[model samples]
Target chain A: MIEDKKTKILIVEDEMIINKMYAEELRSQGFLVLTATNGGEGLELALREKPDLILLDILMPIMDGLTMMSKLREKDLYGKNVPIILLTNLSASEEKIMSAITKNEPAYYLIKSDWDLSQIVEKIKERLSRKV
Target chain B: MRSQIQKKNFEEDLTNARIAAQNVLEDLDIEKTKVEKERAKEVAILLSIGDGLVVTDENGNIMLINKVAEKLLGRKKEEVMGKVFSDAILGIEDKEGKVISLEKRPMNLALTAGTATVNSIYYYVRKNKTRFPVAITVTPIVFEGKVIGAVEVFRDITHEREIDEEKSEFISLASHQLKTPPTAVKLLTERLLSGKMGTLTEKQKEYLNDIRFSNQRMIDLTNALLNVSRIELGAFTIQVQKKNACAIVQSVLDELEPITKGEQPKLKTIFPEQNIMLMLDEPLFRMIITNLVTNAIHYTASEGEIVVECKTINKGETVGGKLLKENYFVVVISDTGYGIPQVQQNKVFTKFFRADNAREKHVNGTGLGLYIAKSIMDHSGGLIWFMSRENKGSVFYAAIPMTGMRTKVGT
Candidate 1:
């Protein structure tokens, strides 16, 4: 299992700087990276590419991450079953996120302001391993 | 200025006076003098208002300047008595020492066109040559079909205006600063977590996840502040058009879907008609509904059912007031969420107001959401209110007037 091929990850983010930073960091973990600028395009690509894991930004133009996630869930097609993590800097409503994690149970809920690169990679590994 | 009716009546009186004079038996002499004196006293009473009062003649020369105007404009009644009203009244400048809207000056048009309009004429300059802010209303006084003079009533608003502006600036600066650090932390964390530096231990990953969660909340607060200020300045306008109510609800839910997860509340909407064409502001209505939904979600227990209903109703019947001429088209959002105490319901509309209980629970509220929501409804010619009990949950309603139904109630 440890010697298995690296998982593919798709990051849907609005900000250019953050998207690049996320892609760069994930790639260094030996994971293949895909990027999209908005939730609409992200959904289109996710449906087509079928990435193993998804890292989505909540605040994005052209259909935000949350809406895209629901659409993917409702259809249960393409990359619909992939483990997804919500990336945001918003600090209030931890319970909302926690409950969401427990239910959709994203591999890990990452708050951008507090988590470091090392921590996020660990989450990706942990989530990938804890399959249903 | 005299209304057309008043001018017509005065002309009629003049004709009667000529007829009475020919008889030489009527008491027109004493009655005529009495009427003029009474009118003068009435004008004097109007002049005595705390606001600056100035009366200008046909040529814009200052016919009268009250005490308040004397102090505010740095000119005495004698000094400004015969001066041009345009120069004296228009002399007032804004806080930045530049003239505010020239068209905002009511006296300018009133003096020329015999039109009465209330405007914020500036008497902002202080007695010591410093600038203070004053809001003035100018109305022309006409008699016998001619504008004899114009009266300007003005008030000093130096302190209030300054404070309001200062508060706005502070909020803007603070929110901007608050957002920067969070963005930076979020950026760097994403870098480290994605393993740019090196592989992370399982425990290290858990800790980072925690850090990320807390940071998410900080961002939400900053965003809330941005919304609060936008609403306060009365600029949170909406796109008004005929739209399907169901479409808006679906979008909001879709927007909130990720958070809805397992505890996904049973959300129901009664859109009796598919093309019911809601004549309202979409973006603004979106904000209002989104905020209330979020509040309900936060307060309600997991898996609770929430009902959102829309129906047109007549409001005046229950309000029992002559003021409410017509009923309103309304939408009601009811939640099986934690209910608010009865005592605090009345205060929900106040700016930045939060219930003590809600605060105790550490609810991250700007307290401005409901206030802004109420104000939005108010200015939109609609009404927003809520009914709740200790454990019975809450029902929040918004009633928007249809078409021309929402006339400006009163000034």
Candidate 2:
């Protein structure tokens, strides 16, 4: 078990239940967490708050998670180093996008529909801590 | 003196005999000429009585025209008889808008080039812009080693073609409208079943899952309907993007985990070191995998092995294995379950058609899964086909093309 207060993370997911579950799970794992329901708020929080890591969803209604991630990265919002993982139900589609993003070496990808909720926090931390 | 007298008489007799003989021969020749004229008139009447007729010489100059040809061409014999065959008749275009030409028209490449020619759905157009849809045949008339003239015969066929097109258009429209209802239901039920909206009991959840299943079945139906329409109208759309075949297969396996949950079936997936990447629409392609794999699980017995095989083949013209193209990755799903009957194998990709034994075992499907999978693969320039046999097993293969499926094949 790790110590408390590791890093702050922001979750950008459209579904309220998923967003809540992810936030609580990350917080319980000793990380500060923030969240946004849509891509616009997620972009704002990801830039202004500048969370240590980001978990994005691909198929959101207004301003999808990918669009938010791009906009933030375009402005160089992550201080050129913040890790971002795209968590999505559309894993196949989002994986291609992530592979392109990972060319710049973004965090990683996890399929939400396939992943157990319990594994999210640990996987995110493990991916962020890795040196590629 | 007697010899002289006999010679004079003979001379007189010869002149008279010669004159009489000359007159008799002239009278007989005139009667024969009259009889020949009558026979020629009867032949001309028979030729003119045809549906339509035109005669052109070896050089394709119009030489003779019957009454039907005169009316059909919107001209009298004097006006049209000397015109070249090109100016004599017009062209006919089929439904796809191909100009179907008559087989023996001299200007037609098929005839003049000495190639075996094609007969077209002919439409005769007059100088006045009047048209007659007719079945026309052209016979090259040869006289003494030379094509002296050609005969064109024709009749009308507009009503038949119009009826066929109307029937096809109606079904296409009806199928399109039928598609929207099931799609709407799918989205709505997915919202309810995903726990996105509210909480539900286990039984309620089961009912909702059933609804989802039934709704999905309808979507399959709607897809088959739309597919038929698209093929007929040649309006099918394919949107291919860079995709990972491994991830797609994983998601499908996950989605159908519910089917194998109680059965305790061991699913072994052989994923590659590098992702199997290709170009395809994710949702549409997912449908192909989901249908095939789910059907595999449905037929297999409990504790049976479902081996998901994935491999990437280098791009080239070599087609060796199932759905394996030279330049793409193929995902093959093999099940050690019930195999398809031999008699029912040929009808696999047919719409709304399923095997009798399959229906008895796994009774729920639109029988359009293989058809749609085949359709998607065909659109993407990929391949999808299967191998099966009774009491053996079945392997459903789906190939994904890497290059953009830029080539569009029509219906």
Candidate 3:
């Protein structure tokens, strides 16, 4: 009998508790989960491991999510094609996030406070299932 | 003898005429001095003005440029006098940094339209090409029903703009910080309720749900406060795109299904068969519809009905007692609920205002929803109004011009 490979997800968030909560939830949902405390580490992990999808936060300490996404997108075909979902508490009306979404073409932009962990898992699944 | 007498009389008469001529010349000199003094006083007044002032002739020529105007423009009065006003300015840009055309210039608009125009979102470029924001007021100098010229008063608004930006930045930062903990609580509670951690009794599940609900409310309050700050500061950005109005309203209704399920008021929608496409900021539009529909659901009784309708209205059509001036895509939300008191109708859109009857009902409300909705409508070049009778029901109308909302760039 052959074992099926689980879909992998990388969560790049600065807040320790939020990162842990999301990772736990996704792990419970039967996916391999990787976590990074900031965008710099996230980018490094993403380039090395090449997760199926990346969950990025906008306001991180070292390198913000947008800058990291831009660098990763420029790296190679794998980095460019991977789906990245932006998770932020900032209002969608923020010009910086709006323009970044337009430029980076993130899979989805979710407001953290407005969404549930279950709903987020559903979104991730939907994104992964879609054709590239 | 008579000829001698006549000659002497003629000489006397000539001497009298010469004395009268000298008196007249003396009076003329005194009057000239008085007139020159008055002219000097007027020039002193113009030069002493604190704000930049420019006077233009009917032909749009710079007649006079005051001291402050010269300093602000980085050009001396002697250099710019008699030059075309728009040409002499060189670079005048709108809020978006786009060069304002000659026809759109405030001075020219005032001249042509014979009305006063006030604008604060203009950048004036100095001789050295350094630009600064300016708040300007231009009024046509009309004399005897004829426009002779215009008087433009402007002041540098760099300090005011900096303060406004600081305020907006502070609110945004504070709101983000305030929301983080609530978000954590919400997510953690959801994780507990997911039942993967451990088996939970009904009581435990109910308690966890309560915590989640309260946390969500805190998150909502923080968001509402942030929105109010943005609206008050005029710092909200608007991105307009062609969108189906009916579809947007329907989406709002769909999102509210969770709250409207079971024994809640019957939700009804009346949309035109053909989609009404209009330019709108989708999220802002959604926010507006959500606010109105939620209010309708909250205020109406469980057995009552709430209707959401969308239709296109033409010019001269009357809505909410006001005659429309142009084509509009309107959404009407009518509810069979506790209507606003007649006296309180005027204050419905004001900030932090809840009706006496609504407060008595004890339904949870911030009273900021309608105010925020109205502000969004005003900024979008739209209209929001309502008609209600106490103890009967209310009909709220929100209309956006068919041409669409004007895109605004702010914080």
Candidate 4:
């Protein structure tokens, strides 16, 4: 644990400010951060990079977080087992998002406005620890 | 000879005057007819409207009914003519389906109160004994300071209600969508303030804190607006799952603890050894508890004592409307804050209604918290009320049914 290298974290968010800020925060926490603007790009990165954890967003321009996750799960066997936390502002009742959640993997829904960045970092760490 | 000529001229002048007076009378008749035509046109316009119109005399007898009214009540204008207003339209009730008393009826109220009663939602039974909701306005026909008659114009609101529900659904969805950008702003601000980017000077940190505070307010406002939209639009959904009641409260307290770090009020928590498992929608339960407790912390003075207690009440105990035989949970959050003004207590739960004292004390409250809480409670088989004294303290009690007694009924 003491000689641990940086944990690779993928933040799939549409908004630039949120993506940049989260990436920086995770970087500060000694996690190598990967960024994607939309779900399509996110799916590509997830397949290529195979990060330690993912922070997914629900809503996006071209293909959403859930769809990307579905595609990633199909393409990568370890994707389903990887810890993914939903970081978005959409309501929990959104049908498409809910369906995406069910079809893919178990993920935590974190409302962006509800939790601070530090709290989100804590959640990411907690989920990673759980996987171990 | 000159006097005879002058007398003859005077007689001619009188004849001309008589002819002029007859012409003036003819013009008056024409004017009267024009005025009568305009009145008829006004009546026709009223009758042509889609809304049902019923005019009653001071004695409450039906004087007139429009085509729409006749169709709505399933009664002909002739059949209901001279009939008592209440008798002809017999099954008049409040929104709750209880018979409206004579005095409480809009027409009667307009007559007695000498004011127009508008936008009252009431149910009217048709001749076929089927009841439908109607939005009505009753205006007293006043003549010489006397209540001569009353005209009630109403519309069958079933279609309108449907449209309203549809609009509410849109707003709920739109509000949820609208929150995404603000959430991004909030996250970035939080990250910046926590020195994620780099070490900052004190002044720079202060500016970031200001931005963070402003961002947090936006977050709270948007959340409140979203909740209100969901409630008002009848788009609220509750999913009941088994969870520990105490854990829910603890999470809410934890969320608020960061804000209350400085000059934190003393929170006394009383939790059971074995946490009672509650069948509740975690979000809704959290909302209710969080609102009450947050209000307590916000309103209370620094270092004031706030007690957050939870216990079980057995069945047959008269709580809110329901007599519960099953185990019910009661969460009491009391605080030594500026208690609600006694005069404004009744309106505490009303939407967008802030008491004078509260408005004077806190500038940030949207006055929608208690309203959203009450609505959640009403739908979730829970009841929320409070006992408060001016300048003393307030104790808010929320009783939730543990058996998931939810109603599909919504306003």
What TM-score does chain A of model 2 get?
0.83
The parts of candidate 4 lying over 4 Å away from their true place are A1-8, A75-82, A129-132, B1-159, B162-181, B258-265, B269-275, B314-328, B405-411
Instruction: Return the top candidate by lDDT.
Output: 3
* TM-score, model 4 to reference: 0.66
Q: What TM-score would each prediction reach against the true structure? A: 0.52, 0.45, 0.85, 0.66
DockQ of 4: 0.38
Please give the C-alpha DockQ score of model 2: 0.04
The Cα error of candidate 3 at residue B289, in Å, is 1.7
Best-to-worst order by DockQ is 3, 4, 1, 2
Candidate 3 is scored at a TM of 0.85
lDDT tens string, model 1, B1-411? 569889999999998988888666456667777889998998789678887788889777887888877877777777677888767444666434666555545776786787777544254655566776566677888899888778888787768766875786577557755875677667666666767578999999888888776787787677667666655543344446777655776688778777666765677777665444566667667778787777777667776878777665665554312234465556677888768878888888887788876776446677867776776776677777777876668888866666621322110
Q: What's the true lDDT of residue B149 in model 1?
A: 78
RMSD of each: 15.8, 12.1, 4.0, 11.5
Native-referenced TM-scores of chain A, all candidate models: 0.85, 0.83, 0.94, 0.90
What is the Å distance of residue B108 in model 3 from its true position? Answer: 1.3
* lDDT assessment of candidate 3: 0.89
TM-score of chain B of 1: 0.61
lDDT of candidate model 2 versus the reference: 0.68
Model 2 segments beyond 4 Å from truth? A1-132, B1-216, B281-284, B314-328, B400-404, B407-411
Q: In candidate 4, residue B118 scores what lDDT?
A: 80
